[model samples]
Target: MIPPAFDYHAPQTLEEALSLLDEYGDDAKILSGGHSLIPMMKLRLAQPEHIVDINALTELEYIREENGVIYIGGLTREVALEESDIIHARLPLVSEVLPLIADPQVRNLATIGGNLAHGDPGNDHPAVMLALGATIVAQGPEGKRSIHINDFFEDFYMTALEPEEILTEIQIPVPPQGSGGSYKKLERKVGDYAVAGVAAQVTVDGSGACTSAGLALTNVHYIPFKVTDGEDVLVGSKLDKEAIEKAAGIASEQCDPSNDLRGSVEYKRAMVLELTRRALRDAANQARG
Candidate 1:
């Protein structure tokens, strides 16, 4: 299928890209890695009159940790995240999830910013971000503003980013000692979108009592579902089998999924419970060590 005709601009600098966005407004689409936008355009799902390619803006490609937060550039490739020593040492949940995103070929080209900015609920990173309580940084003509992860996703294929804003960075605070995180997804094929997925991060005291917890679901709702109710159940508890079962039950009840090619609503909800329990238990075990 042929996409609608569009003017293309490859900007050498971030400022130039912003200028292009300001000029074109809603008529323009920022081309990050093109894995998401190009397919949408071919199908006529997106028909932007202008394509502002930001791939030339190399400043947006990096991964660095400072203070107590690990900052990842929006343009950083998924392969970099998968291979980064900093990511392996600092963000265990992220390390476990990156390789599961897609095959190596896709990961070599997909940008983290595009994955999130696409606002697709099936993307693995959104659920991970939700479980980690990350922050998103957006740059617009008005300069920069920070948005908490919980506030970032607004609706299906929609986000909090303004029309003229570019997502420039993702910031995640380093988890405290004795904290561990895990992500698990059920897919029919190796690179397929999750039929159901869960990400869990737990901080436990030396005595095995959970002090803090984060749980979120993927491909089970119109947006990534954060399981606050489940988190509340685990906190202050010893995270024994009984408490984990209670939290898993709450997740199964709270998630909203529809019948699809992946499975029936009932089956998806059951997988949600199963995966949530597995992720929570694995995270707790890692935290115990």
Candidate 2:
């Protein structure tokens, strides 16, 4: 499929990219890795008059740690996150599932910023970020600001980003000592989007009691959901079968499933319960260490 004709600009600096976005407004689309957007353009769902590519903007291509937060440059590729030694020790969830995203070639070209900004509920990172309590760091003509992952997705295929705004980084707080995290997804096939997925992160005390917990689900709703019962059940208690079952029930109740190629509401609902258990179990294994 051929995409519609558009003016292309590979901007070396953010300022140049922002200027182009300002000029084109809603008619302009920013290109990071081009995995998602280019495909949408080819399908004619997105018809931008101008394309501002920022792959050459080296300023926005790094992963750094400062203070208590780990800042992943918006332009950082998924492959780098999978291979990051720093992330392995700091956020093991990122290390664990980064490779599970699409395939190797796509990972090398897909950017974290693009994935988050595109706001696809089926994508892996949104729910993961929500579970990690991360923030989207963005820039606009008005200057820079941060938005919580909860508020980032406004609706289906919609985001909190303004017309002139550009996502610059994803900031996640480093977990304290004895923190463990895991992400589990069920795809029909290797490259298929998840039928349902879970991201679980927890902080444990010396006695093996959960001090804090975060749980997020994907492919169950228009936006990713943070499962309160699932998280609350683990905190202040040792994760067990009973706790997981109760939490999974709550998480399943929270989902709004629909019939699709994946399955029916009844099946997807079952997945919410089943996947939650696996995710919680995986998280518990890490917590035990």
Candidate 3:
């Protein structure tokens, strides 16, 4: 499959890229890793007249922690996240998700910014970010602004990013002492998208009571589904069998999974229930340490 003819612009700097986006507006598409856009173009699902490639924007390829937050440059590759010590130590949920995204070749070229900005529900990062309560930074002609993960995804294949803006960074608060996170996914095969996945992050007090919790679902709804009800059920609880079962039930009930190749609607919901239980239990155990 061949993408339609388009003028390609490899910008030497972010400013040049923004200028091109401002000039072209709706007619242009920003190309980051090209993993997502290229396939869409080839299938004729996307037909932008201009391609603004930002692969040369080296300034946007980094992973660092500042103050109480971990900042991941939007252009940082999945492979980098998979190997990042900072991610492993500070953001265990993200670390867990990186390896499960796809095969090594795809991860090598898939950028975090591209993955988030693309707004695909099947993309693992959205739900993980939701569970981590991360922030997304976008740059446009007016300058930079931050969007909370809660407000980032507006609809199916849609995000809060304006057409002229480029995602620059992802900001995640450092989990406090005694905090831990995990991701549990049900996939048909190694490279397949999750049939149903859950991300769980929990902070436990000395007594092993959950002080705070975040739960989110992937590949189950029109958008990344944050299981706030499940979180509510877990917080203040010891994450006992009863609490975990209750939260799992809430997640399975609240999610709106569609029937597809993965399984029937009932099966996906069942996976959500079981995966939610495992993820929360694992996260709580990690937090207890």
Candidate 4:
């Protein structure tokens, strides 16, 4: 199917893009990598009267680390993140999950901003971002402001981003010295969306007790589900098998999966339990090291 006819504007500068967004308001859709919007457009699921293409705004396609935080431009591609040594060293969970997103071709063209802004529950980055306690920066006519990951995602295919705002960057604080992160996903096959997925980040003190933990689940709810109860179970503990099991159980109980081609609700919930256990264990091991 073909997308509906629309006016196209390709802006070379961030200010121009913002101006376009301000002018068009909800009638326009920002085109970053085109992976998410193109498909929706073709399917007629989205029929914007104007398409604001920001690909030429090269300033929004960078990855930099400073002030104990990593800042990734909204237009940064998945392939770039996969190859970034800075990302691997500071945020291994991102590197580990990039390959699991889609095929190599899709990853090459997909932008992290597009993936998160699409607000798809099945997208891998949201859960990882939640687990990492990331923040999103958005710019609009008013000015730039930050939104925490916990508050950014509001519902299915929805976010806190106003129609006139554009997401500019993602910020992740550097984990503490003893921190470790891991992602575990179960898909129908390679290049498929996760049937169930879990991302875990753990920080352990010198005595091997968990100082902090973050856990999130994917493809099982309208929004990425942050498992705070599960995280609470791990903190102040040595992350022994019993603690892991209890955390996993709490995560499983929090999931609200619907029956889909990936699997039945029961099966996906079970996968969440199993994957959470494995992810927590691996993250704990890395933290202990």
How many clashing residue pairs appear in each of the predictions shown? 0, 0, 0, 0
In the range 1-289, model 3's lDDT, one tens digit per residue, is 9999999999999999999999999999989989889999999999999999999998999999999999999999999999899989889899999889989999998999999999999999999999999999999999999999999999999999998999999999999999989999899999789999999999999888999999999999999999998899899999999999999999999999999988999999999999999999899889988
lDDT of 3: 0.94
Residue 70 lDDT (model 3): 96
* Global lDDT of model 1: 0.94
In model 1, which regions exceed 4 Å deviation? Answer: none
Report the alpha-carbon TM-score of model 2 versus the true structure: 0.96
The candidate 1 region of ten consecutive residues with least summed lDDT is: 30-39
Q: Model 4, stretches more than 4 Å misplaced?
A: none
Error of 3 at 259 (Å): 1.2
Per-residue lDDT, model 4, residue 256, is 96
lDDT of 1 by residue, 1-289 (tens): 8888999999999899999999999999999888889989999999999999998887999999999899999999999899899999999999999989989999998999999999999999999999999999999999999999999999998999988999999999999999999999999999999999999999999888999999999999999899999999999999899989999999999999989999999999999999999999999999998
Reference-based TM-score of each model: 0.98, 0.96, 0.98, 0.98
Summarize candidate 2's per-residue lDDT along 1-289 as a digit string, tens digits: 9999999988878888888888888989999999999999999999999899889987887888899899999999988888788888889888876877899999989999998999888888998998899999889887899999878989887899997999999999999888888888888989678899889888888888889888998888888778876788878878878887888898999888779999899998998899888888888888788
Runs in model 3 deviating more than 4 A are: none
RMSD of 3: 0.8
Q: Model 3 — which ten-residue stretch has the worst lDDT?
A: 89-98
List, residue by residue over 12-107, the lDDT tens digit for candidate 4.
889999999999999999998898898899999999999999889878888999999999999999999999999999999998999999989998
lDDT against the true structure, per candidate, is: 0.94, 0.88, 0.94, 0.93
Clashing residue pairs, backbone N/CA/C < 3 A, model 2: none
